[model samples]
Target: MLSKFYGEIFAILTSVCWAISALSFEIAGKKIGSLPMNLIRMSLALIFISIFSVFYNGNIIPQGANSEQLLYLVASGLVGFVIGDMLLFHSFVLIGARLGTLMMTMVAPISAIISWFALKEKMSLWQIFAMLVTIAGIFIVIYSRNKNHKKIEAKTKKASILFLGFLLAFGGAIGQAGGLVLSKKGVLNYDAFSASHIRIITGFLGYILIISFTRLWKKVFAGLKNTSALKTVSFGSFLGPFLGMSFSLIAVKNTSTGIAATLTSLAPVIIIIPAIFINKEKVSFLEILGAFIAVIGVALFFI
Candidate 1:
């Protein structure tokens, strides 16, 4: 009986896992920079996910997967990991994870729209209205009142960088949505963990191509020496690709894409407490209200 809601359960767990990883990656990205951090994180994640794969599936490589699954999973990896994560990590560095993840709330709507086109999934009027509420919450959080009642100076370089982060966050959302849609098509009857491994491999290869082309191979070695950063990366690797992403695939496989995406997109709200207390970032009451509104929107999807 409890097994029936596996999709929703895993999706919620994915949000928690992602919140932890986002904070960890934010720290590591700030320390080593996003480019180097990207290479190292994916590399480490591949190692971890591969280890899990070997024990879980009795093989280290994707075996018995047809060309279609392989192709789409590989594409998902390249777009989601290499491109989307680069943009996301940059946003984490530029605007901090709190704002970056908040901006990424669009992943729900993006996923819904893409699933509509690709999988012929349809949304009800109430769901569409809920999506709008989610967007409104994000807008409120992004444009929240400044700390101590201060106003943001629009004509400033800092403001410009924040705007760039916003754009990067949105791009990340689109990339992730595209990847999820592709993975849904690819993971038919495949083990969720196995699918995640293939996706990582594709991202790993994509990163290798980028670094080789750009002559950034040396930077990866340099990044490995950041012991402090590597520690965080290791933790993030386990929480993210190993558990977070695999379960996301499970959610996608077991439930409607829109429902899974909406549940997993709760990271922004989950990160708020850690950001405010642990990270000591200032958050306004308006932001809290906005988060509640977004949660309401997500909850509305069940109806």
Candidate 2:
């Protein structure tokens, strides 16, 4: 019974883990900033994942990884973790988190189309319907929040900046889509955990190179002074890169890329219950309804 659903189960677990990490990362980002905190979390995540890879895979690194595997995984990290996240951050800066998140909903379909062409992966009619349902459900919840609050924290209220924000958000979707497709290719005949480590390595290095050229070393160093932020980042690293991303890879390995993307996209829905506990955000009936709708969409997979 569970075997057939294992991929989706892992994807849902990935969503839950991402919700937890996103909350922690949100706090850390407030304490420190996105770039510096990204470097910190990725560094710690590298250490954590390395240990896991060694213990679980019996190798310090992916000893069996060929050149092609390395290339694909590295590209996945650069596109997904670095470029996608950075562009989304810029969108947050320009348009606000609400709109940015709405834009990110593009990733699932974009990734689906990419996989269809690149990997010759195809979805069933039911699967397509389910994916749209899930995406639409999540969008309804996200859109409601934006409609009620409609807050876009920005220093400048420039029209050009808002337009740029839209572009960046779309770019983020494309980056993530490309990364998912590449990861599916990369992890072929490779250990998922090891592939995840390679991704972490590339993402960390990408940030390092960017910071180096931008001369943000001082800012990065300054971020290290805050002990509280470090603790938060460490926790986030454990949940996100180690657990969340690893499960994500496993999901993709076991399932089609489109299904994995849609299933993992349930983070917003999963975050609601936790929000109740954390008392950070208010939950409403619409959110609850949307979550139920999303679950119905997930259930459609089994049917």
Candidate 3:
């Protein structure tokens, strides 16, 4: 019973962690460029996760990871960390921070649906309706409330790269969905901590491969001098991959993947409070309505 309660708490915290990571990366990406920022931030996450893994598990390598499990972890890392985050970061560079974040909110449903079909998990009729309502709420929230659609007009004036960013975010979503399912499958026979370690190691290798091919090694090292970026990314890593992601795995261990994914999707709403205070973004009536509707949908999911 305690573990279940902890799982629910952690699932919610995962959304908050995601919001923090998104907010931090948006700031860092503004200065360092998305590509460099992606590599640097992910490396920080890898380092943080690795250290935690070592201290907690007494080893740096993946425990009980066979050849097949290693391959799955590597693939998961490549798709999620290397591909997903890179594209999402690029999106932040293309579109303004808010819109990019709005787009990312879609990932949860995408992941939930994919996990459902992949895992052959069953959902109740209410759960399906709730999922639909949640997705509708996302659309409502992202729908421009500007009298003249200022957000869209502004985006049109910016680089066309925002579309690419959306595509990349979508790719990242698929990768993440796949990673979750694969991790669930592989981790069944191992400790969750060790399983997470395997994932981070593979993710580290994926970033390394990208850095080599893109010739971004020099800039990455130079960017290391930017103490501010390092701090942000390091803090984000601690919240995100180390604590947030670990808890997500624990959530999946306790609940259906679809339910867990939906619950975690609440990050976007959690983000609104910060956006208002820090970024000084205005909240529209529609957005407020969407938030309430989404919250109701979340409640229905657990009914």
Candidate 4:
């Protein structure tokens, strides 16, 4: 019973970690291209997850992972880590951090709906309504800043950038949704921690492939001396692939994909706490209201 409760807690923790990672990586990606940052962060994540899984589970590779499971995990790692993060980081470059994260809220519903069809997971009417409300909240947040003429004028010339950012974010949403379903399939027979290690291994390989095609390996080596940036990437890696992903797989194992994803979307709100206090960003009533609505939508998943 305690284990089950902790599982749920870990699921929520996954969201918090994701939020922190997104914010931190956004800052790092601004200095370095998303591809280079991805290579660094994923490398750190692979090493950290390997160490943690070995210490906790006494095994490195996922036990009983068959060919099909391996395929699914590899696919998941490629799409989620490679395509998904690549696009997401690009979106951060195209748009500002807040808007990029807001757009990414689509990941939960997209993944949830896809998981339902692909995995034949069930959802209650209330859950569907909750999803609708969550999307509504996201839209409100996006448009909420529109009412400010000054803000609009400031970002007006960059409309094209915002459009591309939206596209990248949408692509990432699809990748994350698909990745979750695939990971669910791949981890069906293994411990969550071990499954995480497998995913990280594939993710590491995917980044390596990116380096092969783009020759970004040299760039990554050059930027390694930026201690502050490297530290930020390391922090993001620790929160993201190491802890966030491990808990996410555990969440999907214990809960429905839709529920787990919706719950995870709470990251945006968690981000606000840091943004307001740490970043010293101003908060508006509408943003606060939108956050409240999103939280309510997340809560509806349990009902």
For candidate 4, the per-residue lDDT at 22 reads 82
- For each candidate, what TM-score against the reference? 0.85, 0.95, 0.85, 0.87
Number of the top-ranking candidate, with TM-score as the measure: 2
Q: Which ten residues in a row have the lowest lDDT in candidate 2?
A: 148-157
Question: Candidate 1 deviates by what RMSD?
Answer: 3.2
Cα lDDT tens digits for candidate 3, 86-115: 666556555544556566556666666776
- Please report how far candidate 1 places residue 293 from its true position, in Å: 2.2
lDDT of 1: 0.80
lDDT of 2 at 239: 94
Q: Output the lDDT of residue 284, model 1.
A: 78
Per-residue alpha-carbon lDDT of candidate 2 for residues 92-173, written as tens digits (9 for 90 to 100): 8888877888887888899999999999999999999999999988887787777745544333467788789889999999
Which whole-number lDDT from 0 to 100 does residue 44 have in model 1? 86
The TM-score-based order of candidates, best leading, equals 2, 4, 1, 3
The local distance difference test score of model 3 is 0.70
Pairs that clash in candidate 1: none
Per-candidate count of clashing residue pairs (backbone under 3 Å): 0, 0, 0, 0
Instruction: Give the Å error, residue 125, model 3.
Output: 1.1
